[model samples]
Target chain A: MAQTFSASELKQIYDFALDLGRRAGRILIEGVEKRTGDVGEREEGGVGGGQREKMNAVDIVTQTDLDVEAFVKGEIERVYPGHKFIGEETYSAGSSKEYLIDASPTWVVDPLDGTVNYTHLFPMFCVSIAFVLNHVPIIGVIYQPLLDTTYSSLVGYGAWQDDGKVGGKRKRLPLVNGPKAVLPREAPKGCIFSCEWGKDRRDTAGGNMWRKVDSFVNMAAEIGGRGGKGGMVHGMRSLGSATLDLAYIAAGSFDIWWEGGCWEWDVAAGIAILREAGGLITTANPPANPETDPIEEVRLGSRLYLAIRPAGDSEGETGRQAQERVVRETWKRVRALDYARPGA
Target chain B: MAQTFSASELKQIYDFALDLGRRAGRILIEGVEKRTGDVGEREEGGVGGGQREKMNAVDIVTQTDLDVEAFVKGEIERVYPGHKFIGEETYSAGSSKEYLIDASPTWVVDPLDGTVNYTHLFPMFCVSIAFVLNHVPIIGVIYQPLLDTTYSSLVGYGAWQDDGKVGGKRKRLPLVNGPKAVLPREAPKGCIFSCEWGKDRRDTAGGNMWRKVDSFVNMAAEIGGRGGKGGMVHGMRSLGSATLDLAYIAAGSFDIWWEGGCWEWDVAAGIAILREAGGLITTANPPANPETDPIEEVRLGSRLYLAIRPAGDSEGETGRQAQERVVRETWKRVRALDYARPGA
Candidate 1:
């Protein structure tokens, strides 16, 4: 049986996660700002200004990433001694890539999401913190320092965005005044689609990279183009951060987010937030069996995710049915991508 | 000969444009907010709510767009009676699009750039205003109301970003404290590239859509992949706003912006701001003759543009040379595109 927490206990954990996320955000902002300053000095011909040669863009592991992860891990351990912790930095450090999640009170954290955006000073990086109990995420908090925004949610409770002002009012998710609109009849054709070109860039035939590019083109082409596989989405946005992509979906700004290859820490917090806002998540690709439900097959460590925003009842269809319909439509345009977690 | 304005005259114009942009932004905020509310009501099953069926994403012309343009045009005409004006809404409404620019003082404006984003409630839209004299952009101001940020510049003067606070200090463009860094030796390899899918989605063989997707794939694939034409860029971002993309280039956040099929109004303000920050603008496609300079071949009316951020100096090479070198390298990977203005 799944363990459950009282509402009061969940609130306490959510509060702690929000605080921790903000602390991690400060570290990210400071690190990126310092790096920006260092780059400026280098351009101005300053010698020995703490500048290190970046080996490559994809492999930019800054001291800040380590620092933020370490700080968050230490705090969680100190505050909740009985809870387990799994972080991106620590997980990557270990050789084992088997499923780290289990039926326990655990904290999954991505200390610095959007590392490339951070390195480039793109101002989209964030700190994501999620608390999972019994293999299910129960609380989530994501803080973007530059934007001074925080997105937080608790199981059985709604999501909210805090603008980080001293006396600012927190806005409820789906930010719309009432129920969310149902998915458009044309589905992806009128939807704003979000995805990422992740770290893997191999272009072998039928490889992850090729499939991802093909999927993007199929979604972007005209409706009748690409041999009838075109989705012709209203817009395609790649913000380089899975956490923010999910947060935007919860905020009702992004209509859909389809991604593969990201780990649990990247989506755990986002998933919690998205779910609280009435959004749904399922497998990126359709199930082989015609009658299988995609949502039932999705796991936290699945690595492939297709998320849709809340769609309330419209045109004689239920909100859930509308979301499922759009998901099926999107799956048709997407070429299947294979991304197995280590030891999966 | 190009007409010149005194520093005092330019400053006054810049201040007026800034004010005009902010005023227009108010209308946009109101319009989007009202629409969000209306949609909420419709979703909640409220009867007779103010809702209209949108025909398509590319052609979402909200009343806000027309209102902002009318207000800005009226304000400009009132302030500078002798100056001419060309705006996105007005231009689109007119049947003729033959080189609207002339060697005269004029104001080119996109009252609402990123119309799709705005209609979808994405916060990346902005009001762009540019002042041109003798076919040269002299002053530019772009206001993003959602972020409460403003980017402005004057020819021969510096560019600045105002955070929209009553007493907030305006930061200088290229926001770094010192000189800007030169392009990476690997050119687009370490660059953060930004582009738009645009309104045109025609997919004929070798058409604009195919060429764009091919170019994007080439830029994103691993180096030495795609038959030795891969760029392997660090990150790819599509914010769905041409104006903000160029402003980000000026701010040194976005390293490169390669776009085709945008209008003069979509880029005039951003071009002035970027040039003031020491950035470069050139043709997106290579010139036929190897000896021809891409920068020299580019004109204000050119539908294709490739822009690079300010690069001060590095590794014994001048900033100009570094920029030119990157441009040449990028050209090798781009597929030529054709986008002619009507009646051109």
Candidate 2:
């Protein structure tokens, strides 16, 4: 039998996660400020000092990442006692190379998503916290300090965004309040596409990197280019933060977000929010044969994922059908990428 | 002989530009809100209505864009009666397609950049204004309404940013105050690169679009991939806005911004801010030969531009030399693109 969470219990967890995410956000902001010399004494400079400074910036990110993870872990353990926790930093520091997600209530966290953006002071990093029960994320919170925005969601409950203004209202997700958002007539052609170039940059023949580049070009090319594979999406955006990418999709700003080579923690919180906001998450690649292979729901452990925004009725199709249509159209334009988890 | 303005006069102009930018920003915000149904009544829905709704959204952007241009042009002409004006919408609406930039004191403006982002409510659009004297931008203002931030600069004066806080202190450009910033040891490696895929989606062989796609791959691939043509940059970000891209380079968050298929109004303001912040702007492509063709300064009319962030002394080289080295290294990895202006 599975353990069930009540609505009130989930609300408590959501509040806790929101609080924890904001606290973690402060640490990230402070780390960036310290690194950029916004709040502390300046570091001494010398000839050939660029390398040292670069190392120092990396150190700040690492330290802040560790600090946020430790703080969140400690708080969760103290409050929830026996709940399990899996964090990016902790997992990387552990000796065990393999792990499993069983029937356990667990917390998955990316203490600092977009570390590169953090180091560069690009203002797109965030703290993402997700509570999973039996391999399903039920509670999510993602806080962006620089933007002062908070996105939160609970299973069976709708997602919400706090715009971080004094006395500001917390708006429901899919932000189009009353009416349902209708997909563009041509779908992907008028859609805003968002994707990230992850850490893997290897470009071997038919490698993941090659597939990504090819797919991006295909999507941005003219409608008749590349033998009709061109999508000619309204825009292509890479914000370097998968968390924000998913959040934006949930907000209905980004029409689609496809990504590969991201860890579970990077997408867990975002998945919870996206699903609750009426968005869909599926495999990044399409079925090998539509006549035979059915589209699969992306698992938490899947290294590749595709997210589509919430849609309303369009062309005699329901919202779900519209989303599926978009997914299929997008899949047709992109090459399938292979990204296996370590020791999977 | 030419007319030269005094420092005090330039300061007055900068202040006026900043004020005008903020006002234009408000109009942009209102337009976005109105289109998103945040500020106005909802529209009636119908079956298969996606195309009509999209047209409505595009109408909002066009109306807002024209409104901003008209507003800015009116104020500028009223204040500086004898100053010449060239705006994105005005130029497009005029009968003559050819434009000339002589020695006149002129205002060049892109009332709204990133219209696609605006229609999608992606929050990266802005109002850009530049005052050009003798074919050089002397005062620049770029205002981002969604972020409530302003970036302004004047020739012979430093670039500054106001963080849109109540009583927030204005900070200098490069955002690193005390000490100068140093470029990474293997710059282009540890640098954050920003670029845009403009409206030109035509992918002809040996054309600008193909070159851009190839260059992006080289820049994002592993250092040895593509037969050592790879750059392996820290990250590649496409925010879909050239004006903000250049402003970010000036702010030191984005280390490099290489763009093509943009207009004089799109870059004039950003160029002034970047130059004022000790950054460098040159042609997007490299010179023919290291010993022969010298690097040329990017003109206001140069549709292609490459911008590098402000750098301090590094590796026994002065700040300017360090910037030049990064530019050359970046140029080595990217293919030269040709974006000829209409009737050129």
Candidate 3:
């Protein structure tokens, strides 16, 4: 029953969504500094008076996330009333099996991507919205309000960043002093890498994930040449926010971020920005016998991610090769972990 | 004999040292980023031209660190003339017990605190400068230039933060925005907690840390919770820089961070900041015999660490008691590994 929109309409629609996303971000910023000192009713979120919606048992979902999502969903519905939609906490009840198995256009959203941080009052979460067409993600926008950074792209506009500044002084991002000057380079060991724990409570993939992370630490410090004892990894860091993690990579804050078990909504926006910054996103664990084109299957919630910064001072191929090496190392690390002793 | 001076003279000495530290930081930042991204060079830091000065295998001593120390030493001579100085990379050159071993007022500096991060281009590193009064750190200033975060304190006067903003004014921080707000009355099953790699790279400690992290995840989503599957650790993050890690604890971004194998200098400034932010810093692994003292033991390089936000959120008398139950549960998780087997 949804009406299909043209390409120009789609860009305009996404642009509108970005506006609402920024507004929501501002509200969150104001609320975080307010509700986060000493004590407040925001804790024990309840259905009753003074209580906000609490996600799961511990995460405190504030009016901010709810308010933000409502505003976001409203704008989407208003512009494209007939389009199919899905959201994190609220959309589940109305979700159908068709979206997963069908070939229709659908919109997926995680308004406040890092919900726990939002609830606990940590500041790095983001607003993620993606448009999928015929089962392929074609339009995405990842906006992190706190840092005032935005990543967005339409199938071929190429990826770029817009400093989420107020008003419309949209500056095309990566403010690269030069284009094509950037390239992917070898991932330096002894640097911080980012990862997360997906909703899988059972320790199935948890154990394996830990092994991979542990090996990453060793590799980073081992390369640093610390005598007494230190992994080549300089240090390992998990910032608790996907949007910011990718932004940092774009800005050259953290060297590499290998992660898994995240949804497309979580990465859609950042993907655009990372790409704009000249980074590559690949599968962390592609099968040894991959299908004809395994790259086509990479999706959010697929439990695999490897993103490397496109080096700023080298040839493009160098950057491409560097990212590939990191991908291979991540796999090797995984394999090493697989063969590691049971106790490990 | 080492000369001693008044606080005013010490202030001048510190200023001079700070200048040297900044110069060293700039050198490191440039090398890590612009030089070349080589994981091998990172892992095996050999002598290189332009800003790099390699030491022996398992260790790297950049010219920046040495130059900074020399500048600091010269300034110290200019200000206090004979103040004793001891540095990490320079310790081996002398056997004189008078500097490190003997109890004398000394300036202990980790020119590059997170050296591996420096080598690998990871941003979780710092310049640690602690003025030890007779081997006890009295005045501490840990500067993370890349992030423009400066944590400084002189015992009596409270701690402060100078945002990474180069030209920005110094801000009296905890930004208090201080202390974590108390959890809502009915807290969720699992909350976000952070754990990190200890200097001890043993499989047992490594396995134990993961078990503890897993316990938090399982506790969060414990089945029957909305949006949670039994394990729901909001998120796990590691920034690689101990200085930054501890600083985040002080800043309240991290709810809890458990670490091991760090020194007094590594924590002194942040511990003060964490306490100022109303957070608790305790032993990650409780001693067989519990002690209720605010500070304990001469075992920093060997023991584990546990830093919790809002210092006194839990009603229990000790951090050990708060996390003790989880520790027991973690034992079984480690059983699969021989190093973690009983009666090692």
User: Candidate 2: lDDT over CA atoms?
Assistant: 0.81
How many times do residue backbones clash in model 3? 54
TM-score of each: 0.90, 0.92, 0.65
| B54: Cα error in model 2, Å | 13
Q: iRMS of each prediction in angstroms?
A: 6.8, 5.9, 11.2
Whole-model Cα lDDT per candidate?
0.79, 0.81, 0.52
Query: lDDT tens string, model 1, A209-284?
Result: 8888888888888899889988889889988899999998887788889999889999999999988878889888
Q: Write the per-residue lDDT of candidate 1 for residues B1-344, one digit (tens) a residue.
A: 65667889888998899899889998887675454432321133221121432333223346678889999999999999988999998989988877788888899999999887776666688999999998888899999877668899887667777764323446666753232265778978988889888867887877888888888888888999989988889889999998999998887778888999888999999999989888889888766642345456357888889998887676688778888887877777887889976543
For candidate 3, please provide the TM-score of chain A on its own: 0.71
What order do candidates take by DockQ, descending?
Answer: 2, 1, 3
The predicted structure with the larger TM-score, 1 or 2, is 2
- Model 1 misses residue A187 by how many Å? 1.5
Fnat by candidate, in order: 0.31, 0.32, 0.16
Point to the candidate with the largest lDDT: 2
Error at A300, model 2, angstroms: 0.9
- Candidate 1: C-alpha lDDT: 0.79
Clashing pairs in 2: none
